[model samples]
Target: MVDRCSLEKEYILSPELKFKSEIQQLNNLPKAKKEFPRLSEVPSQVLQQTIKQLHKGWEYFQKRGFGAPRFKKFGQFKSLLFPQFQENPVTNLHVKLPKIGAIPINLHRPIPTGFMVKQVRILRKADKWYASISLQCDVSVPDPMPHGHPIGVDVGLEKFLATSDGVLVKPPKFFKQLQSKLKLLQRRLSRKKKRSKNYEKQRLQVARLHHKIDNTRKDFHYKQAHALCDAGDMVFMEDLDYRITAKGMFGKQMLDAAFGQFRSIVKYVCWKRGKFFSTVDAKGTSQQCPECGEEVKKDLSVRIHDCPHCKYKTDRDVAAGQNIRNRGIKLISTVGQMGKETACADELPGAGVIQSRQVSQPRQGKTRKPKK
Candidate 1:
């Protein structure tokens, strides 16, 4: 089993650095491209040799029909380009790098059970070196969740998530708290000359602060997922796209909370433990009453749900959770068992055990790759 724990700051830099690096590369491209005019004629060895900090570098190459911008680093790049790989991760995690030697890693979370660390990636984010350990586990996938208890989780912009149990997981406002300080750091960053020693030092400080907020968010997600798992054998919730979208840019609080990360962990852990994990329609989960099965008035400001038709009242999140649980029960049953209450838990051919509750993901979410 290969599991990826995206240390928050590490992820933050991967993209932010990528963006800044793009700007810098564009600035340098005219000169570099002119100098290496006949890049097509360059030898493969020359190509690799010209690339310093190759792993940290990203570029595109083309001659034939296929041309794609790609990362060309050693360890990090190799892991992405190739498939089968294994390496023992450094326990104390400090190994070696171009500039920084073995650095300290505060690995507070427990590593996956009974897996040998295959590789450790030393990356420079804004400041820190996080060890991403790929583990190979001996364990096999788990059986499905029993039908006795099903869960549904509703995700929203106003509320982090509403569970079938009438519970809510509030999105931690991590970044908002540090926004002022972060702004100061960022302002300080802009004041410094680009690539200067002071700029580099300040960048590291910003990276560390970002790391702290991310750490706090990650801890909260783990605790929530663990609690969710204990509530039922199967966990049900929408596979929500918590990322910023065209409609609006998602808030920093959403990113800091990392709801998608928690969902992913819940799915993997549930599968590992033979519990049912699934999702259903998210659009109207909250608008429809779980008790009466009727649409009701709901606003962004309202936390408690009160249905007029059925005289139903519950926390909005909890009501959504119940609806999810109900939907989950129906989803777990295959066609052959139609109308047969006893055969409700019958598993589909590829769905593992009869208790398998994994829902077929909708096409819309397919376009975007899930990131930690």
Candidate 2:
């Protein structure tokens, strides 16, 4: 579809290549089935869903600046979505599909009450097949309010996370642990002929190892996120993009740390637990002193934070966390009017400065009438 649209202005164009409407695409499915008999094997809805998915990507490309829609190589498109169901397709032991019969599957946990199963997606990873079921509930939940102790977190390759409350967690290098074994498997795979039985077997082994590492890293992230929520009610983190860091010299370590995934998990866990989560400006977080508002410049090699002005010394990461915490507190006070509503006024490092500003600013009351 994209190719056809791109070449629409060309002098010589193929008569068979026409960018059809979605309805026209659906109508042509019968003709397509005649040409490719395998297409008739799957449910019509599933095939329609695939076409809709392609259109969605194209639409997104039109709206967003970059990222043009392209073809997926064989085995790249891994999942099949069943958008709607007239009956409950999942049970304790079996999940029924439209064309395929019931297949035995382990239920991770029973679906909660009052939630209806909206859709099911079947996906394959390594040698195992799995189904991801989507559930919907018509309920409104309020956002968690900012309250209690605030904790700032700093995540890096040195430490998985450092909290304002003086807790430090070391990163568990999941991929590095299995890299040697994975290399051995890949070397053996390279010796085998492509598409041969032994080659396929070796490929599965490599994929399974990668899958295991991903699972381990994800498990660790969740554990750390839950621990953070347990430590404080209000969680603050620096708003730094880890993607840029992933292209630097320590790219592998940055990717292995998976800070972005960890932050997302922390945010979700905070919301689930009714804890407030926020991100502060990342500029000069490590350079600024938490004790005093003076800048103490240091290179990346300097792990220790020694502030000459205030004689404040601590781990650089911990100091960053503390600065993040202070900034978060100040941010909440200014936005939420915590000085009048909460007892956080006395806790701010620059309490006098904040009080002066609060006194100078007028309350946001009703607008006054314009002079005639």
Best by TM-score: 2
Which pairs clash inside model 1?
54-73, 55-73, 55-74, 87-118, 145-276, 163-321, 164-321, 164-322, 166-318, 347-354
Model 1 weakest 10-residue run by lDDT: 361-370
Model 1: per-residue Cα lDDT over 123-167, one tens digit each:
454444455555677777646735434557676656666665555
Q: Compute each candidate's TM-score over C-alphas.
A: 0.62, 0.85
Give each model's whole-structure lDDT: 0.58, 0.81
**Could you tell me the lDDT of residue 32 within candidate 1?**
64
lDDT for predicted candidate 2 compared with the true structure:
0.81
Q: How far is candidate 1 from the true structure (C-alpha RMSD, Å)?
A: 12.6
Instruction: Give the alpha carbon lDDT tens digit for every residue of 231-253 in model 2.
Output: 66778999989999999999999
